[model samples]
Target: MTDLELTELVKEISLADFGKAFKHQAMFNRRLRTTGGRYMLQSHHIEINPASYKEFGTDELVGIIKHELCHYHLHIEGRGYLHRDRDFRELLEQTGSPRFCSLVQSKARTKPVKRYIYACIDCRCEYARKIRMNTARYRCGKCNGKLRLKSE
Candidate 1:
């Protein structure tokens, strides 16, 4: 749906589910990457990832809206709005909102496996690392022994 329709739907959901009006803007944010939606504390605005709807459809969109709305209402009312807060948890349960937003896939590749191995000269303690380490500057954690590049 369009941004305007998204905003209207958010408002309707806010009023119907929370019995409160949503006066802030709700817009599709293409830049949003990992999470389905985010509630901005400073602007009191909700930004939704467009990919959520494209991948998961309307039910997922509604669920995300509900999750953000929990943050929106609790924050505006000066109640606990953070995920760890009791009020936020209770509001989420009361509204049947998802505890976490659905994860969004990205085009970025996974990190390469670690290949470098460093060993302590005195203790033979080994460390696996993805990147090269400066042996001269670094020492073993247990014995402060000199470290050497053991293997790739």
Candidate 2:
């Protein structure tokens, strides 16, 4: 859906769930990579990740909207709006909103990781690691032998 639809949805959820009117803007932000949505404390605007709605559908979108609205309403009223705050936690439970949204599959890392292989020159003991280690500074644990790069 478009930004206008998103704003309308946020307003509706705010009114229905919290009994508060959302005066700030709500829009889909494509640049949001890890989070479902974020409430801007400065502007009182809510920015939602488009991938959340596209991947998880309207149910997930509503959850994200509700989560953001919790922050919006609490902060506007000068109460505790942070996640660790009591007021925020109570509002979340009262509205039946999720503490966190579902993960977006597209943003998850799927690339195969490269492994670094190292072997001892004397004992032929091999070690596999995610990061490359210096052969000159490090020795094999088996026999204290010199280590060499076997393969990447």
Candidate 3:
């Protein structure tokens, strides 16, 4: 959705969920990584990750708006607004907002990881590591046996 649509949605959710008006701006931010949305403490603006709406749809968008609104309202009212604050948690539960938004599947890494397999020469104990290790120096933890590269 457009920034105008997002701002309207934020305002709507704010009024509906918290009985408060959101006077600040709400816009989609492509730079937001890992978080669905963030409430800017200094500007009181809400920035939502566009990837969230694109991946999860309107229901998730509404949920993110509600979550951000919780932060906005609490901070404006001079109450505890941080995630760890009682006021924030209470507002989340009260408004039925999600404590955490769903992960954007598109942003997640889909590449298969390559693992290096090693075996203890004496004990036959095996070990797997993401990075290849020097078998000459690294030994088995179980019996302290010399290790050898088995497979990748």
**Model 3 lDDT tens row, 79-138:** 999999999999999999999999998787676575888999899998878899887787
Pick the lDDT winner. Answer: 2
Model 3 worst lDDT window (10 residues): 105-114
Cα error, candidate 3, residue 4 (Å): 2.6
Which candidate model has the greater TM-score, 1 or 3? Answer: 3
Local accuracy of candidate 1 as per-residue lDDT tens digits, 48-115: 99998898889899999999999999889899999999999999999999997666566334788989
lDDT of 2 by residue, 1-152 (tens): 89999999999898888888999899999999989999999999999999999999999999999999999999999999999999999999999999999989889867556588899999999998889888889999989999998898
Compute the lDDT for candidate 1.
0.91
How far does residue 147 in candidate 3 sit from its true spot (Å)?
A: 1.2
lDDT of each: 0.91, 0.93, 0.90
TM-score of each: 0.80, 0.85, 0.85
Clashing pairs in model 1, backbone N/Cα/C closer than 3 A: none
Estimate candidate 2's alpha-carbon lDDT, on a 0 to 1 scale: 0.93
